[model samples]
Target: MAGYATRVKADIARWREAGLIDPATAEALTRDVAANERASLSFGSILAMMAALLFGAAILIFVAANWEAIPRLARVVALFAVIAAGYVGGAVMKTRDHAAIGEALWIVAAAAFGGSIALIGQIYHLSGDEASALVTWCAGAALAAVALRSNPLTVAAVGIADAWLFLKGFDFFGRAEFLHFFIVMAIVLFAVSFWTRSQASRHLIILSVLFYLVLLVGDYDTLRIAVPLLIGSALLFAAAVFAGDPIDRILQLGGRLPLHALLGFLTGIAMIQFELADESTYASGFAVASIVALSGIVAAIMLAGRESRGLRWLAYAGFAFELAIIYSVTLQSMLDTAGFFLAAALLLGILALVIIRVEKRMRAAAHTGAAA
Candidate 1:
């Protein structure tokens, strides 16, 4: 069968080199043919499967025997024991390096066994306080991850532990006192972000910032506090814009700006709701002015950096937002919401024409330069 498969591959390669098949088509065919060969297992694969079965049975029996009196520490110890045994068995069987289907199955089995042990402990009320237990479990899992060089499991454990900590900290206490905790969490997340270069850690940091915003601004009736948040959000957006990579820049910038906008919009609505317009009007005006100013700054940066699409989007969003505010103010005076529809149509038409003319000029310049 191996010889037959090799011959088939050779024939395909010949056809590819002869220009009888496109490169992508040939590559796809090669992958399809290779897929079947990977399914075939050897003696080592069978041994790995048997070891996995025995390990699973041992874990099940251990859990069943201790079903009535297993303390949290005992359950933890038993789980570690199973993991250690599995690692040793895999190491001894020399099946660790096998790249076959059965090896993958056994690896999955090991992971499942570990996860099941943790779940069983939780089910039996042996996991203790959620925060403490999660921390302990995450620490253990992290150690195992380092030892086994398993990144996915490490990330999973870290995420679970962090989530548990956040929930525990946030629910019991409001954001005022929780500021310190969130800061610490952010530092930890930042460290993890750099260490693993994982997007999840970065996202966690962003979330921490959002939580900080809520804590700081949720109950405030003052602009002094809110203005700083708007500034911080603007700075964050600016940093994202100036980032080296386009995709990362967009993601980071996009994530923070919407929150900034939402917070600003909601704060405006809240001020209206509470009739705190006298104090809030100044803040609202300041925020709008700041947004307009920042929009131009971002546009300038984008244009200077030759980022056409990003600049265009930023400019359009800024324009639309300002126009919406104008329409809203007019609607309040006219008591006619239908007027906003006309204003929107006019704004959109003007924007569309401007964009088209700009694009046409750009194209014309490009063509002229090319001809030159």
Candidate 2:
């Protein structure tokens, strides 16, 4: 949005030169664009992310290797030292306007929290279960994110939460159920995303959820996983398409969740379709795929994609990919189903052209009426 607004500001300057607007209007436009630019992430955020990853890796490797010269207690104490130094340094840097460095240090502190959990657990010869330690680390990160409003820490919290669920969710409550933990962690991560108002954190949350679901697929059958994914896509598509204005307004910061969820779900379903390419299921899959694909494109354009460039492009790609899959599966059926797909694409193309023409005419009529 900042980039687009900046380009529009440049266009406005050109328009001012062309006498399309006055100097005052140009200045006002430039100010609005500048404000939009302020809404974007700073170079510091990117720098902090990079620094956190680099330093965090270094800390993990050192701890994971366990230098025998340093006693286990000393090693654990050193990790705690890092935690204190990082947080204290981050607080001082924050006060000194070194926000990026502060954030990076905070990330280091949070990561050290996790490392400390592991080291402390090992020192005590605690139960080998990983979930408890992960939860403790996640709790620390989550507390820091909320207290400091740190986006990177929120992402780390989400990652920790996802890992904990993936590793021990099945047997956590002695119930051996995965969905329970998934549901709980999802609520926490999503709440953090909104609270932080960080686009990167939100996308990281999506990536975490996608990772969990794909991992679930690894542990289960393709069709069983595909069924839930397809169902989820249908739900998102339906809500995106038919939801009222109030609901759409509430989804303003959802970014690409609706669109990408559809992508993940449909892609999984497509994989299943390829695996189970039988006559009965193939025909049904084709019908389901076409409907979901078309509906997804329309919903993306009208609801999610209108405001999001990434989602719009992803929708276009998904639609095109679905067409390819449909064509591939139908080619063996004597070109009958393939022909249907081609004809449908042709019809949709014609309809799009017609809509464009109508929109152009309507704009022209509006301009004429304004002049009159």
Candidate 3:
């Protein structure tokens, strides 16, 4: 939004100079953009948020250190008091128009709610796993995010949701049942992100889902999972390319939907390649994966690179990663690898030429359409 505001302001200046818009109209437009654009967090706000977190951590540590000496009733009262103070203080700050500081305080209060849940449960000798406790904590954070309409709180809630999923076990494999719960929580967080306009939270949720997909393939290591992932990722990438605006409208993620979809597509390709390598067809499988990854990168550059620098950079990173993996996988056969790279390079060179021609035609067509 900050970037958008800057661009709009620049355009307004250009229009004023060209006499397309009067100076008065341009000034009004600039003021409107400034009024409506989402403000970025200042350095002070960042420090305040960090300070709140540190203070909350210190209070929690102090209380825990003297837990046995403190009366149980006093402990409960103290925890509730902390939570109330944070919320009430945040409300006051918000009323005074210190929104960033208010949101930071709200985050502190939400963190305190989670801590209180854990501390109270421990004090009462409640029976439950860490995952269950995290689930409760996540629920509290999520509720706070929705009620306060705080992007920072929404991000915190998303992090708690991820933490809940991670608490399942160290195995990082097949928890099909828990994955269902994780998906539900992710959906809730994603929806809350829309309400809070938290693009960061949405990114976290999507990345978490991608991580879960990786885990699924890692655990299953079969065609059933790998094939579906590949097909699904491809379809998703296609939709992101062709229907990006609609997806943006629905997801409200600006221009990042396609970038994320490209990542998921590459991940699916990697998953399939791993399956093939495990099946003892390493050379052929790795070659196919390289081609697919290279093609995806090229397509992204040709299709969306003009609009999204992030997407282009992600493609570049994917290309480097693909090269590194291929080199490592073929380390034992360096001679064969040399020849293979020559052949692959020639193939890709030809593909690049075709893509260049196609992109030129695409630009010409777009220019013609705009002129019309």
Candidate 4:
């Protein structure tokens, strides 16, 4: 939203200079955009968040250093006191219109809540594993995020949840139940993201889901998991593209969902290619993988290149990687290598020509419509 406001203001300036609008209208538009722009983390807010984290860490360390000297009851009182102070201070700051500082303080409170969970568990010799602790911490962070609608806290919750899943990567084969719990947690986090409007949390959720799929492939039948992953990612990317406007209306994610989906799609493609390379069906798999990779990159560029710079860059990287893989896989035979490159060059050249013509026609149509 901040980027959008900045671009809108720049366009307004250009329009004013081009005599497309009067100075008064330009000023009014700029003011309206600025007024309506959503609040984003400024440099100070980021620094405040960092400082709050450090402060929370320091307090935890201090208590740990003096754990033996501090009585159990005092320790409990002190923990609650810090938590109360943080929330109270945050409320006061928000009432005073210091929203950035308020959010930082709220984050501090959330951190304290997590720390208290651990310290209290230790003090009482509570019976639980690291996974359970992480779940508890994530739940605390998520509650604070919901209560305050805090993006930072929501991000913290998702981060904690992903950390739990990452740890489970080491031992997920036996704990099949973890998959069900993880899916439920992911769904809850996704729901909380919509409530908090946390884009970072949404990105983390997508990445975590992909990570879980990778873990499944590592533990189970690779072909079964990889094939479904590829199909699912493709479907997800298609939906994100074709139904983008409606999704954005509901999720308010600013078209970022498609980029994340594309990442998953590319990852799935890479995974499948590796699996195929390990099998006896190498030749057919290579051909199919090359075609899919190249076509996916070209389609991405043609669909979203102008509107999304990130998508364009991702496509470029994917194209380079695809070519490199093709060269490496066919390195044994010089003829195969040369033929592959030649074919790829010809096909891409044809795609380039088609894309150029399509873009030209679209631009001409847009101009005609505007002129009318």
- lDDT, candidate 3, equals 0.80
User: How much is the lDDT of residue 28 in candidate 1?
Assistant: 89
Residue 149 of model 1: what lDDT? 46
lDDT values for all models: 0.52, 0.72, 0.80, 0.82
- Residue-by-residue lDDT tens digits, candidate 4, 54-165: 9888876865664788899998898888888888899899899998898888878877887788788888999987678889989988998898888888998998888888
Q: Write the per-residue lDDT of candidate 2 for residues 1-372, one digit (tens) a residue.
A: 446777898899999999999999999989887776655557877877698878887887766666567888788879989999988898899999887889899999998888777767766777855666777888899888888888778888888887776666454545355544665766786787667765666666666666667667656786787777777776766665566345445644444556666676567667566555665524666566565557556645755666667777877887777777676667767566756767777867886787689879999999999999
Better of 1 and 4 by lDDT: 4
Question: TM-scores of the models, in the given order?
Answer: 0.50, 0.79, 0.89, 0.90
The TM-score of predicted model 1 comes to 0.50
User: Lowest-lDDT window of 10 residues in candidate 3?
Assistant: 169-178
* Candidate 2 structure, TM-score to reference: 0.79
Question: Top lDDT: which candidate number?
Answer: 4
Evaluated with TM-score, which candidate comes out highest?
4
- What is the per-residue lDDT of model 3 for residues 1-372, given as tens digits with 9 covering 90 to 100? 448889999999999999999989999999999999987778998899999888778766765574888898998898888889888899899999998788778877887787787788878888876677778888888888788788888898888878766655344443445355788989888989989889999999999988777656545655666567667777877787788888888888777887888888777777766566554434576677767778778877877887899988998998888787777777777876787688879988998898889879999999999999
Q: Which pairs clash in model 4? A: none
Number of backbone clashes in candidate 4:
0
Per-prediction tally of clashes:
0, 0, 0, 0
Question: Residue 279: error of model 3 in Å?
Answer: 4.9
Task: Please give the range of 10 consecutive residues that has the lowest summed lDDT in model 2.
Answer: 244-253
